[model samples]
Target: MQILPELGAAVASRRKHLGLKQGEVAAMSGVSQEVLSRFERGKVAEFGSRKLLAILGVLGMEIQFVPFIPAGSLDDLRLERGGGS
Candidate 1:
């Protein structure tokens, strides 16, 4: 959920970095320009994961998930639950 904005920002940044317009991305990825605009605005719920992945592939980006552990007390609890010794 929180990653949506990050993903949008990454897409926007990458597009800009590559000097590509939204139309170019839309054509390359075979997604509608309207959808690409929505994606850039972080309205990711409207698009399917496969379409998003295709668009990202054109941008030379891939999604990666890294497990996140909260700091302080939460981290301790996670470690304990995982049998850390």
Candidate 2:
């Protein structure tokens, strides 16, 4: 459920699949190479949304949010099933 690492992996995989270099992507996305590197490394906790969107744009990708269970929902289900929370 760690979203950042998943996102970073997705970017890195797509970038590689597209045969794109970090420098090229950085320039195209208007982000620094170091920032791109860090993002690809899953160090994106501090990265801004604008920068992330810009990078995704350069990679011909888009971000989407999916609906999911809220906090404690899983625990509630577990307890209902006679399982420990």
Candidate 3:
């Protein structure tokens, strides 16, 4: 799942790339213009999946899931270094 900020930025960038305005997307997606604006700005605390899908549909974008790659910890900080003490 994408973070809200990233999603919002992507939507904004896509919309701009398509030469669409917030109001135009809002009308086409059936989402309020203010809500669309807030979402584009990543100012909304909560956004529903339906709304997100609708907006993305209008923008000709879709969400994708990818494997989460865990970060590696510092070997020196690990408890078991497997080295002669």
Candidate 4:
């Protein structure tokens, strides 16, 4: 739920691809076993970004952002002030 399922899947997939165990990943990432278990089960929202980053780092992953649209498009929009023109 809440976009966590994809994250969990990614973590799980990456972990398996790296041939790492849950406990091993937890130890390497400095996250708790319970938290890692939950995350692999698609409960990533329960964990914070810091913890997620730690886990992802151990999995050889890092967070990155990509813009979906041009920045100027947002600034061109105007909000209605009231009934007045």
Candidate 5:
């Protein structure tokens, strides 16, 4: 999975592991439940990055820009990860 969906899954997993419902997280994060649900499902194609960061903050997470890797390197990593088609 790409980073966004993977991040979403991680957030969902963490929320579930903490015994927090989507509505509770949304309320605590000042986001709508629908938005939170969509985000958790990785359907946030139109969601803003600011809101994403806000949710991450509420989840005790943060986003960071790490060093870049070339597309070829990513492909090689994917293949090594057994994600190749």
Candidate 6:
């Protein structure tokens, strides 16, 4: 699964749902705003897992590993599995 896009989207959505700006999340996660912005937009080539975990921690989010078969993109797989945001 192309986890970066899906994970980024979830983080962005959670951050927005919490009424937070990128800078706030970046500061809380100890990541630069530029990196956070790039990550949110799914433009980042690679991101540190610790940084990602920190962002998720700040957003009160956690990663769940479902049964994934990698049929398509993560979004497609989620849809196929009836996962909701």
Ten residues in sequence with the least summed lDDT for candidate 4: 76-85
Q: Which pairs of residues collide in candidate 6?
A: none
* C-alpha lDDT values of all predictions: 0.86, 0.89, 0.88, 0.81, 0.83, 0.90
Collision count of model 1: 0
Q: Write the per-residue lDDT of candidate 4 for residues 29-50, one digit (tens) a residue.
A: 8988888989889855566888
Better of 1 and 6 by TM-score: 6
The reply for model 1, stretches above 4 Å from the true place, is 70-85
Q: Candidate 3 on 6-83: residue-level lDDT in tens? A: 899999999999999999999999999999999889898889999999999998899998888766567643635665
Superior candidate under TM-score, 2 versus 6: 2
Model 6: per-residue Cα lDDT over 45-68, one tens digit each? 898989999999999988887785
Ranking by lDDT: 6, 2, 3, 1, 5, 4
The TM-score of candidate 2 is 0.81
Worst 10 residues of 1 by lDDT: 69-78
lDDT of 5 by residue, 41-72 (tens): 98876667887788888888887778876666
**C-alpha root-mean-square deviation, candidate 6:** 8.9
Candidate maximizing lDDT: 6
Model 6 TM-score, 2 decimals: 0.77
- Assess every candidate by TM-score: 0.74, 0.81, 0.82, 0.72, 0.73, 0.77
Q: What is the TM-score ranking, best to worst?
A: 3, 2, 6, 1, 5, 4
**RMSD versus native structure for model 1:** 4.9
Model 3 bad stretches (over 4 Å): 72-77, 80-85
